[model samples]
Target: MKPFKSYVVRTNEENQVTHQVEEVTESFLGEGNTTIAVEYSSINYKDMLGLQTKGGVIRNYPMIPGIDLAGTIISSEDPSLSPGDPVLITGYKLGTEHTGGFSEVARVPSEWVVKLPENLSAKEAMMYGTAGFTAALSIAALEKNGMKVEDQPEILVTGATGGVGSVATQILRKLGYENITATIRKDYQEESAKEFGATKIWNITENESNGRPLNRREYKYVVDTVGGDLTADVLSKVDEYGSVAISGNAGGVKLNTTVLP
Candidate 1:
């Protein structure tokens, strides 16, 4: 059989990172229970990291950098998964530690695959990818933590213009949450946030930090896609018994806050 095309990332001994599209054979795929004909994949921040000189995301050299993929199963050794089945794979050290979705053909453990739901198409699933999945998962976690849309009408979403934040805002609105506050760093994103179902917009760059240990409670539930000090800020302002779901660390990874709030 002919080699399939794939985007490959390689790092040199001097820490120079190079990315290019190349043809690969099945032998390069390593071991897997399933082989998928990848139809869709999305470019994410992680993908950019893989192309950086010292991004530290790639565990090995000569890798494919895409965390999410949706496609039809070309073959499967696992009894549960069959050929021609539509499936989606995300996370689980995909782009970082393994041959990822940047290739026309992707092979992964069957355990890492999810049967594509009937309501969603392969392209649509890629549109959601890790970003949308994170949003939905964060909201689900909040709900599971006793958060109620009816009670917590004014929920907060940070990094509102981002992939996760935008999808989270829209999902909240669709779920009947009337008051969604989307916090953004840019002024121009306010209207876009509102269009994504945010009723209020808070510009993080324009807003001043009070530097207090705690602040008045404004929201019962908050989705903090951008973590670090921003997460600490959101946690401090959450109402008593309120829940905050933090899914990303784009801002920073460290959380510096008092135990009081």
Candidate 2:
């Protein structure tokens, strides 16, 4: 086959960032038991930040920046993956430390690749991406921490217009959660969040406060994708002894709050 094109994020020996969308020969691909002809890749947040002007996401030089990919195996020696097998990969440092999923073809370790499930197609799998995965993790955390439909109060999902929030709302609704409160940044997303099962929607910046140490209880379980004051505020609003699953740092890092009795 001819040379394949890839968007490689390179850092020099001094840890300087460089990005290049160029063609590469197939021989340069990492060696693995399974060689896949990549068909689809999703641009998750990690992938976006990793391919920057002065890339801070990449640890090694000349690495491709993609965290998720779905493709068919072109060659494989492993029993779990044979030629023509459809597969998808996420996490496992595929894009961060290793040559990633952005190329036309990829050679991934068989252990890291998952055979596409019966009901899922390659395109469908990529559509969910890492955001959906995080949402699943958040819901799982909520469930493990004793969240139930009988909790009366709704589940609060912050950053609701983003990828994780949207999917979590859908999943919670599908699981029969009666009330899902979505907190988004835009007024337009209020409608979308409602459609995704949010019975109530709030803007991220709409409710201004005087940094109260505690607030009225509103949520039973909270999925916070935006950290900082938002997380602190959610902490105050959660029902007594309730739990929260938090991910993301787009809001802020240091949280300003005091634990209430």
Candidate 3:
């Protein structure tokens, strides 16, 4: 109804990308069945790339960049939601192809809104955001693929200090898994990894491969947030009948390894 503040990223005719906080109206929110009072939003890797001129994360110019948001509904055409209902939205083209949550207000298709769990607050929801959701999804997928904690199976979480890995580790611990092994790129991350419930830490640089197509079986389950050579190497070390849930590709996209593992 009134002009509100929004952070906008625009590419000029010169192809230079710039971001600024500016005043906008409800019309700027674009089409949606629901209008929300945005309480919080979190920055993710995609959001960072969206600010770069050539990041390619943004499908169009003059966009908002946050990928995760949590807040209250102001109005909704969807009967399932009410004006004061607490809700959250992640993924689904928010902050990329759509007017996102980096504003005082956001409007999204009601189908995209998720009612916040009774125990979760908007701020807390944002604290978990997309990374935590991805981590939980990875673990759920691993469980669906036959990963179990009853035997105290060894679980490896790559990028243990990162957003997804850290959340994954804690969730595993909360689920009563004890043999959680975390992989990190630096020695300095050891303490933080352990704090996130890693029972052991493996430094990537220290674990050079022996050049074998397959290595000794180590972990029964792996949450691989880092891709590239690390994934190739780790796959060789997973035990027979093991499962690896690959998530992020912060390292690289290529997977150069044999199927023997």
Taking all chains together, each candidate's TM-score versus the true structure is 0.96, 0.88, 0.96
Tens-digit per-residue lDDT, 72-176, candidate 2 = 999888977778989999988778787788888888788899998989888888888878889999999989989887765578988888888888988899888
Q: Write the per-residue lDDT of candidate 1 for residues 1-261, one digit (tens) a residue.
A: 469999999877787998899999987774698999999998888888888987989978889889999999999999999889999998888888988999999989999999999999999999988999999999999899887766745699999899899999988898989888999888888889999999988888887567787898988899999998888888778888888999889899999999998
* Candidate 3: Cα lDDT at 5: 95
lDDT score of model 1?
0.89
Per-residue alpha-carbon lDDT of candidate 3 for residues 95-190, written as tens digits (9 for 90 to 100): 999989899899999989999999999999889889999999999999998987787889999988999999999999999999999998888999
Ten contiguous residues with the weakest lDDT in model 1: 145-154
> lDDT for model 3, on a 0 to 1 scale?
0.91
* Candidates ranked, most accurate by lDDT first: 3, 1, 2
Name every residue pair that clashes in candidate 3: none
With candidate 2 superimposed using the best TM-score fit, by how many Å does residue 69's alpha carbon deviate from the native? Answer: 0.7
Ranked by lDDT, the better of candidates 2 and 3 is 3
- Model-by-model lDDT, in order? 0.89, 0.83, 0.91
